[model samples]
Target: MKPQIACVLIFLSVGIALGECDELMKELGRSKTSLGGLANELVELRQIQRRVGRRIRSWEDKARQNEVYLGRLIEQRSISEGWLARFEEINRKLLAGEISSDDKEERIARNIVRIAEFQAKIDRRQATIDFRIGKIEKAQAQADLYRSRFEARESVVADIEEQRDAKKLLVLTLEADLEACKAGMA
Candidate 1:
């Protein structure tokens, strides 16, 4: 009777152990699936970062081109200023009676026309430069917005990875506990 009772007790313990193992296996499977989903989300975040990087590069290129154009405009303005200064000196000499009145008048008229044309060209170029600068600013703002979004996504991914690691540790601990329980029954 004692042996029979022991056999019954061992059979019941084995059955309970198997049940626990099955449950643990199911939990491990669920955890693996969750990790896989998180991995996919991480992939998406990487793609977003790549796209934002490309946008930043394009914006930088445009800004470089705008800088080159601005430099050219500055050079042109500098040249125009020199011409205006020379014209002023010639007029001053004419007013002091150092040159003939007719010659001075003709020279002054030509200088005026040249100055006006230079001013018109400068104005047009400035308007274009202003437009380009505005575009560059807008693009920079847009790129910054994207960069912030990418940072946010990166933080989220980091958090998910942390959670997944913790979950993995928990699953391992649970597995160890289940194994211990089975060993005790055996």
Candidate 2:
């Protein structure tokens, strides 16, 4: 009877240990699945961050290119202004009869026309530069928004990484514990 009772006790102990082992295995599976999900999430977040960075760089590039173009347009307008001033000075001299020319009237008329037309062109270019400046400002604002989103995602990724690492440690511990438990059973 004593031997029979000892055998039943041993069987019960083995059954309980097997149950624990199964439970530990299930927990380990769950941990691995969760780790995989976290890794995938981290990857997706990184991709999103990378895209945002690209967009930011693109916006900055656009702003830089437009700034360079604007500078050129401004310089062109300055040159045109200088030319217009000289044309007006020459036309004034022609009108005042300070310069000797047989076709003085015709030359004055041509200078007037050229100054007026060039002024109009300069105004149009300035308007275009103004509009482009506004657009660059808007693009900068959008890039700032993307930067904020990237920072937010980076924070989330950090959290997920910490959780994943902890879960990985738990899985390792469980696996080691399961092996020890199995050896004991054997």
Candidate 3:
């Protein structure tokens, strides 16, 4: 509202004195052209803002999926750890026993091998999960940055709208003054 008043005051300073109708029409033309351009720019900015909003939603969904996947990975790791512990306990019990059958010895050997292989698999999967988590963090940061840009652009669009309204009022005032000046000439 203040901006509208300021615009009117600025244009009023153009002096309502007669004989300047030609200059007034020229200024009015320039103001109209500027207003049109601003309107186009506002439309473009709003479209871009909507696109940004969609992108933000997409990233948020990705983040939620990543969290669920991460939780599953951690749970899987814990279950594997429990299995490894049981394998070690069995190996200890066999070692503490007296002489055993050949089949029992073979069973003990397989148990040790299984433990080592299972631990290696768990380690690999954990590493992969860690890498994925890093990627997720980076993507989230990018989303935050884009959200900030969208908000700033939104503010700019509002300011441009205000300026456009002010320009419109100025143009109307100029047209009225031009008509009055022409009437005075007759």
User: Using TM-score as the measure, which candidate wins?
Assistant: 1
Candidate number achieving the greatest lDDT relative to the actual structure:
2
| Candidate 3 residue spans exceeding 4 A from truth | 1-57, 98-102, 154-186
Number of colliding residue pairs in each model = 0, 0, 0
**Which is better, 2 or 3, measured by lDDT?**
2
lDDT of 3 by residue, 1-186 (tens): 999999888777665543388778889999999999999999999999999989766887877788788888888888888989988888887887753545777878999998998899789879978976986897789888988999999999999999999999999999999999999998
Model 2 gets an lDDT of: 0.92
How far off is residue 37 in model 1, in Å? 43
Tens digit per residue, CA lDDT, model 1, 1-186: 999999999999999999999999999999999999999999999999999888667886777787787778777867866776677677777778877776677887887787778777767777776887787688677778978999999999999999999999999999999999999999
* Candidate 1 whole-model C-alpha lDDT, 0 to 1: 0.83
lDDT against true structure, model 3:
0.86
Whole-model Cα lDDT of every candidate shown, in order: 0.83, 0.92, 0.86
Lowest lDDT 10-mer window, candidate 1? 80-89
lDDT of model 3 at residue 119? 99
Clash pairs, model 3 backbone:
none
